[model samples]
Target: MPLDRAKTLQDTMTQWRHQLHANPEIAFQEFDTAKFVADQLKSFGIEVQLGLATTGVVGVLSKGEGDCIALRADMDALEITEQNTFAHASKNPGKMHACGHDGHTAMLLGAAKILAESGTFRGTVVFIFQPAEEIEGGAEVMVREGLFEKFPIQEIYGLHNWPSMPAGQMAVGPGAMMAACDTFDIVVKGRGGHAAMPHLVVDPILASAHIVTAVQSLVSRWVSPHDSCVVSITKIQGGDTYNVIPDEVVLKGTARWFSPELGCEIEQALRKIIEGVGKSMGCDIQLIYDARYPPTINTPIEAQVSADVMASLVGETNVNRNPIPSMGAEDFAFMLGKRPGCYGWLGAGQSEDCPKLHNPHYDFNDDLLSLGAAYWVALSEHRLI
Candidate 1:
């Protein structure tokens, strides 16, 4: 019955999603996207609040005196160029909704329209349209701007489209759902000289290579075998000429872990490795490490509530109650930290070869729009009742 109610608006939601996909905006620059969302919420007769985190929008719908809950959806796109040949392909060059944020925004909007019209719940529902989820930490910005302080929201919920799972499936658990993300940069300084006479100068490139190999030990050797951690050197920049070695080599990379204590240990061990390698290679290496998003951990009760509601829509067998956590990071962790909440993954994959998130060829599955919207509505009604 819940899914049927949402299916009635699937066509309208798909149109909204396509419109948003065609005009993709990134980060805090979601001005047009914010206006579109505000216009929709106002048309639905819900109270709209704007200007939080610059482009964030909140739509409140209250029917009676009861608990207040918030459902969030990200609205920003990524910086990757589009590769799809569909009619809804991105119009903006070098910007696309490769991460399914358009689908997320549309689904939440659909749920808002249904809730506003039906008024099936007794309490208040807060619809949060967030921006800059790619890498700018927009959720953190919203929290710092006093999101919870302004609204008496007791619980929050967030959902993201997962490409690895089959369409219409759902996953939620009580522990960490996403890993903490941290970045580091190492600048190795050495003496530059001709490549032909390698003995005459200190090669920072060799030192950088050693640093990379040594940092892998941070996960394999330094961290426990039972625990999970990832250290990747994403960027390496050093020399321009083939005949000479540059004086400095800059290494940029990221570290991921679930526990805060493990995060600290990883950073400390990483700094020590860099310092030792620099000293051994006769180079001066400067390390700059920044801790970004924290692990997304869900409260037990809220996670159970989400799972129960999901089961009601698509049986318990379709729901994954104990799925493994992902290494990818989400800014929604900031909101979960501030309030009791749960973050879930809605499967969006259409086939085994479906393009993954952040890929240029990736597109959100429109068929899942109704299912996701229905899940949101069901959760709202279950919690409010």
Candidate 2:
């Protein structure tokens, strides 16, 4: 039954994906994109609700009587300039759907259409189309705005397109599917003086250099060798003239960790290292750390359900249960925090040798529309049955 429906739905989804790719919108600014999604849901006789997080859209479909399951798709584009030479290339300047969100949105919409038409499920399905996933936490905002309270969902599921995996292959895991992203900034205060006269004033540039090298050792030496952590100093700013020592130096970077305890330990170590170095060098240090989304942890039972559903749809051999976890962060972690759920990766494959997400050359693989839509349908049917 899904095979026949997949064929027809594939064509429709391709068109929808192309339209979205051509007219990409950035985070929190998905006005037209939200309108298109809402209109499509309304046309299919699904109840549509908007204005959850500015441009967020939610569609509800109730069949017989049972639990409510929610499916989510992010609707925001990156700030990258489109480099795809295809006819459906992004028309919005400096904004492109390099993350394959166009495909994600289209696939969920396809599932909605199938559910609306077949009505084979015995429960309700809530389709969430969110915005600002690239910058501000769209899922976080939805939760803050009473998304789950207003529409009571039992389990939530999210899917992201994976470029490295082969087409038609799916990856799912039980815990720590993605990392927690935290950003930090440190400013070292010192007195400016002539470069040739070292004894005249305290130099923060040298102190910052020492701090950078010392911070790198925290993960390698201080933290457990088995644990995974990344501390990278991406930016450093200081003085202007070469002959004069700067009064202060600023350091900016990000930290990623899969374990919550390790994440906390890293932050604590950073503070100690920064302040210790500052005090030793006769300088004052100010540090600010902002925590983003938490690690994406999949419930054990839900992970098994997701993997089983994919295996049933596309053979057991095509479904991978122990795929490697990614260090990148996902806002979907917020939704998973509220309800037991699982997130899986949909293979996008290599198309025109496009670059990865956030790259200017990256574009969603439209050819995988049928497979993605079929996966969504199979997951819904399997869960509800």
Candidate 3:
């Protein structure tokens, strides 16, 4: 029965997925993508509201007043250039859906179509198509602009395609499903001099080097060994010339932690490290730490619901209720902060050759589209009933 139902929508969903994959857009600039989604929803007889958080779309489908559950799918792509040479490859250069958000959107849309046609569910199901999830915090902006106030949704739900896990399985937990994302930028000012000189200048570059090494201790020493966290130095900019020491060196990186308190702890420790280096080097150092996404914590009850529903869809053996949490951050954390929800993972593949998230060759697994859409339908119906 599931196979036949999925087979009916497989072709249409694949076409929609390919279309979205071919024309990838980035955060806050998903005008075309939002339009396409709205049009699709409208064709399915769903009412859509546009202009929330610049390019967000809300599709409302209601039978009778009871409770509302929102299913969200981010429509923004990354700034990566597509490496796959397939026929459905990205048409826009320097932009691709490396995170499988295209698949996510298509899956939700498939559920909307099935529900609209069959009219099987009760109450209301809000389809949230958000923009700028990659960088602009579209969920945060929507909440600030009264998304809940307008929609009055009781519970929200979201999902991401996890390439590390095999397809046809779901992994979730009650606590932190994903970590908080915080970014830091440090600038050190020092005297400039030629490399040939030994003691003529305070080398900002040297101080930055030490600061980088010191900040790593925040995770290894400041945080507990049992805790899950990451402190990575991703970018550094200082000198352009070959032999001349620059006047200032800039260091930038991201800090990730599953514990909410760990975000502030890392920020404080980062400042201390840079300040201590500045004092020791007798130079000026500035630290800027910005709290981005909060920890994506699933409310216990909702998480249990997700686990139960997915188990019914597949089987108890295929569902993981206590999978390890990811250090990666999600903007859905912002939504979960305001309301109760479960942000889950849908396994894409586990093979070593499978492309991972943010990789240039990464692509959404199309085989999971039917299963994902089924899960969305079952989840919304279960919650509403």
Candidate 4:
């Protein structure tokens, strides 16, 4: 029934999703995206608020006096060039909607229209369109800017499209749903010399390589097999000429873990390894580690509420109540940290060869528009009741 109701708006939602995908924006620079969202909310007769987290949009709809809840969707795109030749492929150079935020935005907008017109739910529903969910913590910025203080919201909810899972299936549960992400930069300094003369000069590249290989042991050998932790050295920059050894080498990577204690231990162990490697190789190492998004943990009550709403839309069998958590980080973790809420994953069925999120060839599955919108509507109606 909810799916049927949501189907009526599928055509329009698909168009909106395509438009957003074509004109992708990144992080706090979602001016056009915010305006489009605000205009849609205005058309739905919902009160709109802007500039919360520098382009974040919030739509409020009140029918009666009861509990106020928030349903959120991220609106920012990634900085990846589109490789698809589709009609709606990204027009913005070096930016693309590879993370399916376009569909997330359109679905929530579609839900706002339905909830605004039907008048079936009591109390208020806050439709939050967040920005900068990829790397920057826009949810944290909104909270610091008094998002909850400005609006009388009790609990919040968020959803993300998962291409790895098949369509018509959903995942929600209590406890950690996503890991915390922390970035580290290590600079190795050594003497410069010709590549042919290895013993004649101290080589930073050799030291940096050892540092990289040594840190991997932190996750594999230091941490227990039962615990999940990741230390990856993604970028390595050093020499300009192949014939000469560079004076300095830079290493950048990220660390992910679910528990705070494990996170601390990871940092300590990583620092020790890098420092030890640098000392052994006679190189000066400078390490810079920044704690980014926290682990996204769902509260039990709201998790059950989300699961029940999802089951109502699809079925008990379609809803995965105990799915394994992901290593991928979400800024929604910031919001869940502040309020009791649950963040869920919506399956976007694609072929096995299809690219996943952040890939240049990846695109949001448009078929999921109706189901996602219906889920949001059902969630609002259920939670507000």
Error of 2 at 49 (Å): 0.7
Tell me, what's the RMSD of every candidate?
Answer: 0.9, 1.4, 1.3, 1.3
Reference-based lDDT, each prediction: 0.95, 0.89, 0.89, 0.93
Q: For residue 93, what is the lDDT in candidate 1? A: 99
Q: Each candidate's TM vs. the true structure?
A: 0.99, 0.97, 0.97, 0.97
Q: Lowest-lDDT window of 10 residues in candidate 2?
A: 347-356
Q: Weakest 10 consecutive residues, lDDT, candidate 4?
A: 348-357
Per-residue lDDT tens digits of candidate 3, residues 1-385? Answer: 4334655898899999999999999998998999999999999999999999999999999988788899999999999989999999999999999999999999989988987877566799999999988867999999898899999798999989999988888888899998888888888999998988938999998898898888878888999887888999999999988899989998889988887666668888888888999999978999888889888999999999999988977788989999999988899998898889898889899586788999999989999888888888888878887
| Pairs in clash, predicted candidate 1 | none
> Model 2, 16-130: lDDT tens per residue?
9999999999888999999999999999999999999999999999998888899999999998888789899999999899999999999989989988998578898999999
Clashing pairs in model 4, backbone N/Cα/C closer than 3 A:
none
Tens digits of lDDT, candidate 4, 151-268: 9989999999999899889999999999999999999999999899888778899999899889879988999899888889999998998799999999999999998889888778
What is the RMSD, in Å, between candidate 4 and the native fold over all Cα? 1.3
True lDDT of residue 155, candidate 3: 94
User: Candidate 4 — what's its lDDT?
Assistant: 0.93
Whole-model lDDT, model 1:
0.95
Question: Considering lDDT, which of the candidate structures 2 and 3 is the better prediction for this target?
Answer: 2
